[model samples]
Target chain A: MSTNNEIEKLRESEERYRTMIEMACDAIFVVDAESGSVCEVNQSGLIMTGLAIEEIVGRPVWELFPEDERDRGRELFDTAVREERGRRTSMHFVRPDGGRVTLDVTTALMRLSGRKIVVQVCRDATERDEFERQQARLSQYYERLLDSLPVGLGIRAAINATPKIEFENQTLKRMFDTAACKGSGITWDACRADMDEQPRIAITDDGSYAEERRLANGQTFLYTISYVRDLLDQWCEVTIVQDFTRRRQLEDDLEQVNRTLEARVQERTRELEEKQTQLAQAEKMASLGSLVAGVAHEINTPLGALTSNNDLFIRAIVRLKKLLDTSEVTSDAAMKERFDRILDSIDEVTSVNKTAGERIKNIVNSLRSFARLDRSEKDRVDIRDGLESTLTLVSHELKNRVEVVRRYGDIPPINCFPNQINQVFMNLLVNASHAIKDKGVITIRTALEGGWVVVEISDTGSGIPKDVLPKIFDPGFTTKGSGVGTGLGLSIVHQIIQDHGGKILVTSKPGEGTTFRIELPAR
Target chain B: MTASSNTDAGRSGTIVIVDDEEMVLTSLRSFLTLETDYEVQSFLSAKEALQYIGANDIDVVMSDYLMPEMDGISFLAEVKKIRPEVPRIILTGYADKENAIKAINDVGLFQYIEKPWDNDDLLIILRNGMEKQRLMKKLQQKIEEINRAYGELEGLHKEIVKTFV
Candidate 1:
């Protein structure tokens, strides 16, 4: 019926079909359309159907099916032949090893030489279904996780311009007084009053949990807010609120305590300043009283001399008058000699009077200066007056023992407390005069440098001992022999100068002369 | 020239002592009148002394450094302008080094003396004050004499020119 070339073509096509069926991973079974016999079968199909090709060959593919299901398998195969297409269906097959394999069977019809063949592609779908069931269990587990989480979490549906509450976790329901504040979509405005003001969270597309929040129980919290945008870009705000209310309260209390402490410290400082001012005033008054006493002692000496000289002059004049009254033209040598002696005595009295009177006037001027201070308390005082006054006060000490040389310079009036400055100079001068037992020169000089007035007092005297030098400015410390000086002299001097913001430096050697350098700010 | 109309050195000049304290003024006046040849007056205030100075012939003016109304420095400076030849001196109690320097530099202070002063030292200062006063007067006389000679020479030259013409 067929030539060799045509037979060869048919055989070749059949061989290609056989190769495709045998090598397939899926279960492939070919059924004869007209005879309903099993024409071809793959290894998986034979293993899956619990029947070998020898038993199934030239027999209907429905033969291996159980008697009840043989009709169903035959109907499905007949439909594929009629439709010439395949569609998926779930089915159970008895395997060669006596196990059952659930499969998704797809039957396709192929036509060749007026005969229709059914090619069934069966897929082993049991493992895939089992995986799907496991995934469903995992989804239930996640739902349980979201329910039991300790932190207060919430989801809001922002379908409209104003977001509405869609879901609230258990923790959130507990934090707020759920009976009142929960259901009607509570927002920041509803809770941000004295009743409850909690920290608000931010909404962002990218998730970052903020460790800050506010609870509805009138307590602030620390937590984060995340904005979950949907496919429509409408943001659903998911906030994770945490409680840090106690920490905030602690910080507030600490700030309040710090402020109170600062206020107390400032008050104590003010009190200390006031005490310093009062102490300075008291020291000044004490020095003034001592100065008055010194001046009083000085005035008495000259007054005594003047009184004696006056008595001498009056007596001499009376004696000369008496002698003249007695002698009228007599050549009395004794009377003339007496008159000459009386005249000489009167001259001596006149000279002494002049001397003592000037001395008294000097002492008086010094007292006047020492007592007077500018009523304004501080003023531009002629610094020379202060120095001259100090010189006048201490001149007696220097009279014969020390030769005081004034190497004075021009200096303008400087703003200061004049009397206090004078007292400091008086102490230094007196000490210098005291340092010398015999004759030595005390040189006082002054200059202006760097907008400041400098005064230097140099003395040729037995200097302070090196061992006692550092103690010179200490209160109640003295280098002079006891009874000769008050140890407070240098201390008082040092304090007064320091109070006025002046500098005093003393340079000395045991046997060499001493020099005191003083610098005062100029007005 | 403060010489009495008859140019003589024997005429004693008046000396005024100005102090802020009443005790010092009274006591110093009494001592000076009783002991010295000069007519001495004491003023308790620099203002009063200034007022007295306008009409009086004062050769020497002594003032205190510190005072209530005005300090001795200002008063002495004012006195120097009014009567330039009168010698002025400042006496004070404190031996303030800077004040002494300012006093000497600002006002040519005749001398600076301290309290409890030596009697001989005071005498020497007073003598020096009187000597300065005398010297200033003599200088003024010499300056007047030189002026008079200069005027005479000018007159003689004019006369000689007229004769030559």
Candidate 2:
């Protein structure tokens, strides 16, 4: 009975220790210094070291460490066992996969029922180590993204009625003439863009664009600012700055081109209007002149006979009066003394009638010639004749105000429509006469230029202002204030010459005088 | 030059003047009395002159154009109807080319004159004008008298008609 009880108890103790070892998830082992071996290991030890109990039953515990760390590990284990002091150490734990696990090992001396041994407990730390490394990598990635962005970015706080820069990127710090972003910060509106007061750009905030402005220094930058509610829903502004000076210069050039186009359109409109009015005026004046000429020719034919009859009638009456006077003064004294008076009266009446008739003939001849203008109508005639006729027609208006200094060139009849050409001359002469608001000299000259017939008229009148010179030919553009300017006189002159394929030039100086030069295509 | 030379020929004539305007009439009367030798008879309108033409001896006729009812062209046409041999002259202030051509071709008017005429030219034209009128009237009168003298020829024609019948 004693033998049976003793055997049973031994078996139970062994079973209890084995159960403890199997349930533990860490490696459990025993090191025997005298044998230089591991006496036992737990389930985790078997799986971690990739060995079965038979494969490692007596192997040296130091072998679990790499060759480089084995001696140090062994010394540590020996000190912990001899001193009866527990110790913890980390060691390289090799695995079946040919990789390694780091082991956090605990060792202490312990006595089993009949033996003394050192116990080591190792926990695998690889999983915790990997988790920590992953966290470190994530942090580094975030830092790099923040530092490398190109836009000059700045974060500012909106407080105290101004923006205060809280943070600025490297680029933002370099701009704004500051080592750090300062100045209660800059508002979206206050900050200049392209170095201008209004900077236009695309932004993420509610307002996407701003206008471009120029700064006094001439340096340029474009800034865009966005205001957002962050995670805490606090208002914050992010400003982005870019330089757009070159684009603004291009826009300015584009504006200048638009202005030039507008000016050209206006000029073309004026020129066309002038042409239309001039053509109408030319048609009217020509028809009127022709009608007058025809009338004068018809009158000349009949006046020729009527005056001759009048001459004969006057002679007959005079002869009759002379016969009566002879009878009144007869030598017979029987005649009354009053007969002398009657005879005197009859002679006086005849003489008066004769003189008056002669005067009537002169008035009629002048009127007929005035209409005929034959001297002007006939080619190769003297220009003086046309000028005189024009003077006669407008003589009532001229009287004393205008002093005409006509420097008549040997104006050969270069091929021309005499009546029509005379009209041009008349209009210019009249305009020169009218130009003088007061008394002034009008110099009219005509001559032959090379391959061209030139007519020049000058007036010592109120000259066109310098700025008005370019606009003189423009219809409805005149210096004769208010309703004074028909404004079409010079414009008509300009077109008539042009219709003749001639060129007209005007030279004027303010307060000095004006000269009109005409070049006609010579026939 | 041709016109002046032709007009210088005659030294004496009885000239009849016609016009509406008193100034023209008086001045013309005085001018003829002073400047040329001719017996003067003056009337304002063609109606007044028509009476003189029948009874009074007149050497020439000169009329103004554009009278209210009787224009110079129409008056000359009427005178031609009365005596085709009459030398009539028309005076006008207007060109009136259409009317002038009408007068010359249709009425056989002697002349078309525009106003404001030369004095010497007028006298020369009248001298020629008077001679033309005298010759036309004498020839016309002789033809009439010959026709009157030859009326028995028509009686002879009636006798011949009865014989033919």
Write model 2 residue lDDT over A357-431, tens digit each, in one string.
555555444443444433333355444565565656655566788887878776555554455555666767776
After the best TM-score superposition of candidate 1, give how far the Cα of residue A227 lies from its true spot, in angstroms.
32
lDDT of 1 by residue, A1-523 (tens): 5698899998999899888778787888778877778888888777676577787677887766656667877888888877778866777766667666677778888886777887777778888778877888886676668668877777777746666886777676675645445554444323444334444555445666564445455456655666788557887877665546677778778899999999999988865654464466556655664565455545643453454455446544655565666667225777677766867777777777767676766666675565442222667877788788778877778887788788778888888777667777887888888777688999999888888899999899888887878788776687667997657777767776787888888999877778888899885
DockQ of each: 0.02, 0.18
DockQ of 2: 0.18
Candidate 1 has an fnat equal to 0.02
Q: After superposition, which runs of candidate 1 have C-alpha atoms over 4 Å from their true positions?
A: A1-523, B1-11, B94-97
Which numbered prediction scores highest in TM-score against the true structure?
2
- The candidate maximizing DockQ is 2
Compose the digit string of candidate 1's lDDT tens values, residues B1-165.
111312333335678877676655555565454445667777878888898888788878877666779888888888887887888877654434356558756887787755434434654576678888999888999999999999999999999999998
What TM-score fits each model?
0.37, 0.46
Worst 10 residues of 1 chain A by lDDT: A188-197
